[model samples]
Target: MGGNEQKFIKEAFDTNWVAPMGTNVDLFEMDLKTYLSNNVHVTALSSGTAAIHLGLILLGIKAGDEVICQSLTFTATANPILYLKAIPVFIDSEIETWNLCPIALEEAIIDRIKLGNKPKAIITVHLYGNPYKIEEIRAVADKYQIPILEDAAEALGSSYKGQKCGVFGDLCVLSFNGNKIITTSGGGALVSHSQNIKSRAIFLATQSKDKAIHYEHSEVGYNYRLSNISASIGRGQMEKLDEFVNLRRKMQNFYKQLFENVKGVSVFEVPNEDYFSNHWLSVITINPSETNGIDCDDLRLALESENIESRFLWKPLHMQPLHKDFPYYGGNIAESLFAKGLCLPSGSNTTEEEKARIQNVIKCLFKNKIKKKIKVKSLFPKRQRLFEDNMLVNFFTKNRLETS
Candidate 1:
């Protein structure tokens, strides 16, 4: 955690503003508005899932209304659709960016509309901090005249063409869960372009209390307001957001460099300069054929064996038994990603020793294959270094060649 988290959190206790509403919550929301670089209204909530649920409510989603969703995200993104008893039409991810495929999205929209139930809203996600195909997806949503509930939970610092991720949709969600880039310990916020919508969201979050001043409610409500203490932590985390983003990007670069010459392993990256990701979790796809049959799980096990943890990418929601019966579009792209992708340790606080250990583990795991891929410099080269005689490569090569 950033050092100032304690300072802001202490202020919350010192002022006795420990509940959900107070100076901290107000300022934290303001901080997010300013950081989002948009004229969007913000209402801090208890969780990202809550924000999505409220967003769907504000969009007028009712039971049996179909909501289009990206199938490759965390369950939280899609669970809210089920919460409102709305049908979730899951879409697949494209290869360019492992996000909602615009083609599949348009296909789903057309088919659903033909079936007489036009989707109420599209729930798009910037999975793993990588922004979706912003323009393409937006075009599809606009053409279909469907509002979007962007799940920017993993994308607080991510952007596309200089615009931030959270502000891209009609109603957006941001997460500060413990595992997120910057955590309020556990919290989230909803983003909207309309102030009235923000006010309505706040009203619903606080038990829908009426103006009579007594505990009164006319509609179902949720205790979804973020705590003053958590907002205080968010305030501090906001201060160090740029620092965390920079460090996370460095981790991405580290993985890119480490895997540059390694066959079969390719680090996940944006397609172009238009996208800037927080690199929340550096991911890679391991192709078995190119790595002497080593796959993502093999690498994960190797890392685990060394006490360095790694994980597979999210299993597509549609593949889950709970969600298998849901209407789904597209082929096996999400399934392919789940099968081959691995999430590397990319925390902001990872130390130099930890980095070295991680590097050593990976290097050892792929040593045999990588040895054949890297070349040793020739002798008498300018600014020569060790192994100028092509010693290591030639030695290994000669040993194999001699045997052969």
Candidate 2:
């Protein structure tokens, strides 16, 4: 926790504003609004999942309605669709950004249109804080006239073409969970361009009560408002958001540099300067050929044996047991990503010693077979089948590794 979080929490206690509705919550919302200043209104809630559920409702999703969602994102993105009893049509990711693929998205829409039931909304996530092909995806959504619910839960500070990820969709969600870039202990918020929508969200979140003096009958409501204590933590986290983003970016650059000599492993990065990611969790994709058959799972096991936490990328929703029968688009991009991607430890407080240790472990793995392959290739000369037929040479040749 940042040092000021306790101070804000103490203020809440000193003012005797311990309930959900208090100055802390109000300030927290305002701070979020100021931070995301695209004239967007923010409504802090209990969790990112709650924000998504509310966003789906606001988008008019209902029973049997269909929602298009990125298949390679966390379950929270698709669970909200299920909450409304809506069918989630999962679309696979592209290799470029590892987000939603535009071609597959359009194909899904065309197929759904053929069935005479277009999706009511689309939920595209900036997975691991990397922006998707926003311009292309937005064009497809516009062509279909489907509103987008941007799940910026992992991309608070990410941007595409100078526009913030959270401001790209009709309705967007932000998470301040304990494990996110910023923390509110456990909280989230919804951002929309319309004040009316924000007001409606607040009303629904606060139990959809009428403005009557006494409790009155009303529509179904949820107990999803952020508490004073959690909001206080959010307020403090917001104060250090820029610092947090900078630290994360620094860590990402460090990883990129460390992996420069590690064959078969390339740090996942933004495609170009037009995309700016928060680098929320530094990730890498291991090409088995380059790493001498060491895959992401192997690295994960190695890290786990050393008591270091590393994880494989999110499994596509289309592959989940519950979503096995859902409509899907795209080929093996999502599946390959799941098989080869690894998320490294990128906590804000990770130390230099920890990073060096991680680098040493990877170096040791490379020494096992990587050195032998290079030696055999050097002895055989270029264009001669070295250790074995592998994709690394093809990839390197295609990318012009001499210049890289």
- Show where candidate 1 strays beyond 4 Å: 370-404
RMSD of 1: 10.1
lDDT by residue (tens digit), candidate 2, 1-404: 76799999999999998777899999999998888788999999999999999999999999999999999999988998898899999998898899999999999999999999899999999999999999999999999899999999999988888777788999999999999999988889999999999999998888888889998747888888999999999888888898899889988998898888877888999899999999999999888877667676556655665678787678678878789888988887888777677899998888889988887766666666542221111111122121132112442322211100
RMSD of 2: 8.1
For model 2 the local lDDT of residue 178 reads: 90
Q: After superposition, how far is residue 154 of candidate 2 from its true place, in Å?
A: 0.2
Candidate 1, 275-383: lDDT as tens digits: 9999999999988778886666556655666678887788788877778788999987887887778899999999989999999878877878632211222211211
Clash list (residue pairs), candidate 2: none
